[model samples]
Target chain A: MQQRTILSTIEGHAAADPARVFCRFQTGAGTEAIGYADLLRRAEGFAGAFAAAGIGRQDTVIVILQHRPELLYGFFGAMRLGAVPAFMPFPSPKQDHALFWSSHRKLLALTGIRFILTYRAIAAGIDEHFTGLDVRVLYVEDILEGLAAGTVPPAPPAPAIAPEDVAFLQHSSGTTGLKKGVMLSHAAVLRQIDRYAGVLGFGPGDVVVSWLPLYHDMGLISCLMMTAVTGAELVCMDAFEWVRRPTMLLDAIEQHRGTFAYLPNFAFLHIARAARPGQRWDLGSLRALVNCSEPCKPQSFDAFLAAFGDCGIGRGTLQVCYAMAENVFAVSQTTPGQPVASLDLDVEALESEARIVPAAPGRDSRQVLSCGRPLPGAEVRILDGAGGDAAPDLAGQIAIRTDCLFTGYNHLPELTAEKLVDGWYRTGDLGFLHAGELYVLGRQDDLMIVYGRNYYAHNIEEVVTACDGIAPGRVVAFAVESRQMGTREAVVLLEPDGTREAAELRRAVKARVFDVLGLTLQHVEVVPRNSLVKSTAGKISRDQNRRRYMEERAGNG
Target chain B: MADEESFREVAQAIGETLMVDPATITRATTADDVNGWDSVTHSMLVMEIERRLGIQLPMDKVFDLADVGELVDLVAAARSAG
Candidate 1:
């Protein structure tokens, strides 16, 4: 499909149906909505205000704000003026604002953001982070005020946009710490929107209900951008609000007759657990409830069906998508209305035999959920550790080659070169292909998934080593498989510097990590100074430490 | 709790779930007062209390309980009504 600009699509839909509701969102007041015509007006008003603020066509603006209508107006308006919008999440509750500010400073210095769009209160909170930056702040309230006051330059000339022009920068890590902007061109995003949306059978008639954070790729591209491009109705809520009121999501879906939504695995469990007795929602209106951004748990599907099946949710409604910011949005998604195919793998075969064999009904079966086939124009392959193609049913590193692939990392060329080989991007994910469907296992790298958030082992180690009693450069953090939670649990094993009590050391380490990263440690083992093993080069080995810990636990059992 | 005496028992269970010091937790303790008391843990805490007390606090009214005292009263009310 030949596509040039994102605005053209939005404009086309607006021209066709000016009165059609484009999106709906919750505010402190209550539920509010904007029609296509109103959206075009607000977006244009934002672009005009941006132009009045002297924002140039090729500028990069970091759009950080709470989940609100201004998020769209600012983002789309920036794009309208041919400025690239890089979305970052707001300073969420419980988040370490100082760390966020420091990292964002590093990122802004690297990317050279020309402008920032955010609230005054949010700006004040992180004002020190951008203390001396040349970047100008574009407050949301100021823009709205300008529009209201009729001071914004009306009808700012829309810049000539090219398909090859950078559309936006996206970060892969959902929960946020390190910021690596994956630069995507308009062509790539357009291709992704067409192909991914087509396969999912998204049309103007379908309404989207989501509480996924706007900074997240799954929420940004799959839900907001796609729905906007298609002129489909969207019912939205902020991530912070959703965390407090998850059932409100179902309430919106039932109230709006929402046909589609997507969430991570942990959310499925959250919703199921949050359900009150006798509370019912019309979930049957949903044609597909895509599980993505994290490993899709087969058991969560069972739990969801058991909890909400009475609401008319079908077996096929729960689907899985293997996606990343590097690929614009989705590499693959299960066919809508088809039960996500799963395999009960033999655990012994998974290790000893190195083959994925069908599990026997007895003791050692691992139920693995299939993430499904590649989207049109996308190619997925399993590569063994040696870089050669892996045999079917053999788990290996997942890689993708697609037209929608990002150009490269924003400022880290070496990092981009490390992951993108030839044309195929090494996903750092491990999975196997079976029956033309992909079953994602976990990350091949030491990236740990805890409570559905990605945290690198190296980063965790950095935090652990900085603790009071922990020895520097003698820390190892890894994830142990947590069968009960349907995801891995992060565990840390570090050498104490002195004769401090182990329990105290553990508590201090855990508290420091929690304070810095909000990561709750499942296990914090303070081993003897030299108990942890090292490589021949004397570098601490996380894999070896993890193995030893597991063995000790097994022996105790 | 309506009995007021059951407040300590309820407070202890909530504190255990959130890994917070129960003594620090008062009738005005909100979810934000404790670390790790976000959505995931909050739901777990609510479910745990429901299971332990054999009372069903209205999920819709969950946000109404600003602290341990209000939560106790709500739980106790639900129990007595049931």
Candidate 2:
């Protein structure tokens, strides 16, 4: 196979299908569709405008727009000029302004972003914070207006972007409150896109419907990059739209006959709950629903299938895949029409002994669904505490070496060196391979040690969320060191909808945690929904939550 | 019934759903008046009201329902038409 650069592939697709719809955006005005020819013209215009703005090869530019077609234009425009584009998470007022500003400053410092392209709305919201910064800001609409006026200078000759050249940077979810930017090379990105397209059987005829935030890896690389490379029509929506009216996603998918879509586990749960009676949409066109960015819950898959079975969605259409920004996106994807493989293991034994013991069907066991075998050109290994390869059933840290491995953290050699050990990237995810299939337990950092037993926080959260009155997929469980026990104790933070009594809810949470994980929780804090902090990448910030808890405890003391 | 009666019903529902005092909801009252009328809570309000009244409100109208009076009128129209 002749490997081509992302830009070359996109140009080829544009040449082949200049009249085919490439991207669609919906706004208050109405829906707008841009064909491949229009997409290329806009991208070129963006490139020209960026060049006019003094951006050149190796320069970093930050894009801070919501899910709009202009975001894609800005992203590809930067890449077309060989400038590295970093997608920064949109600022949220709910976050601590000081911390958010500091984090943004740190990211800007790390990337050395000299220019930012954003929508006027977002720019206005955060303009105060950018004051005095050396970076220049350009509104996307203004840039488009300049392009339309033909006032923007023509782009310089396309620089020869090598396969190894840094293409873009994606930040980790900062679940531990420390954000690390993953620098993906053009080759790494293209390799993953090829793997993704092949695994999902996507082609130019396919259309991808995505509501995931463009800043996230799953959204930026999988949905945007894959579509750009394959010339697949993409229907993009903001995360707010997806959350507010999940049915709208179904409607758009049906209206566009979208063949491919991607979502996190929470989205499936939300859609399942929100799918009302008498609401129907023809979703038979959807061939694949790539579930990633979070742990794939079998229950969510079951619920989604049951809720929209009439929409032509079936069990085989739900895919469990796993990847990280470091891998440039997908590492493993389930094959179509394959029975969803879920491993029923004894949770007690798995936690206590670090051994995965299979249980018979119909038995009460913790079933961890397989995310499938690694894609071609990717190698995965489970290493024990001593860094030696673990046996098939022994739980250990996941490490991978792939052609799609990112080019280390941007400008952070110390962090890069720590994450990239030997020849493999330490994923910081705890899992074990059984019969060549990978089952990701949880993040190694998120493991809660209680009474000398290891408990995955995600599993605990899943169990807690199953309890009545608790908000599904909104709980955070972590281990805090107990002063009396002189050991880490399980502390579950339940973000309820505020309709339940605190005392009774706490009791129920404690009992549920105890019953599910066999570990007694030391404390349960029922915080408000959205109060439990999460990083831009949508991972729970356990360290930040723990620090906040400690601060609150100190204030009370 | 007049708009005021419809307003009371919607205001009471919003108060119950959001766990705020119904008296606090008024024509000029915004989500800021309630303890937890954030975006997620706002969606919950829309979803609950839609479920109760069996009406599908437009996305903009849902976000535009800033006060109890507007919410009542929207719900009343949605109900009366059905």
List iRMS (one decimal) for every candidate: 6.1, 11.0
Stretches of candidate 1 off by over 4 Å are A1-3, A96-98, A125-127, A174-177, A361-363, A495-537, A547-557, B1-38, B47-82
Query: What is the C-alpha lDDT profile of model 2 across A346-447, one tens digit per residue?
Result: 877787878889866665588788899899888999999989999777899999998888888877898889888876999888898878888888667776
DockQ of 1: 0.23
Q: Could you give the TM-score of chain B for each candidate, in order?
A: 0.81, 0.78
Clashing pairs in 1: B1-B72
| Model 2 stretches with alpha carbons more than 4 Å out | A1-3, A92-103, A120-133, A175-178, A360-364, A447-557, B1-45, B64-82
What TM-score does each of the candidates earn? 0.88, 0.77
Q: Which ten residues in a row have the lowest lDDT in candidate 2 chain A?
A: A93-102
Residue A303 of model 1 has an lDDT of 88
Give the alpha carbon lDDT tens digit for every residue of A269-295 in model 1: 778877888889988789999998877
**Strongest candidate by TM-score:** 1
Q: Give each candidate's fraction of reference contacts reproduced.
A: 0.17, 0.07
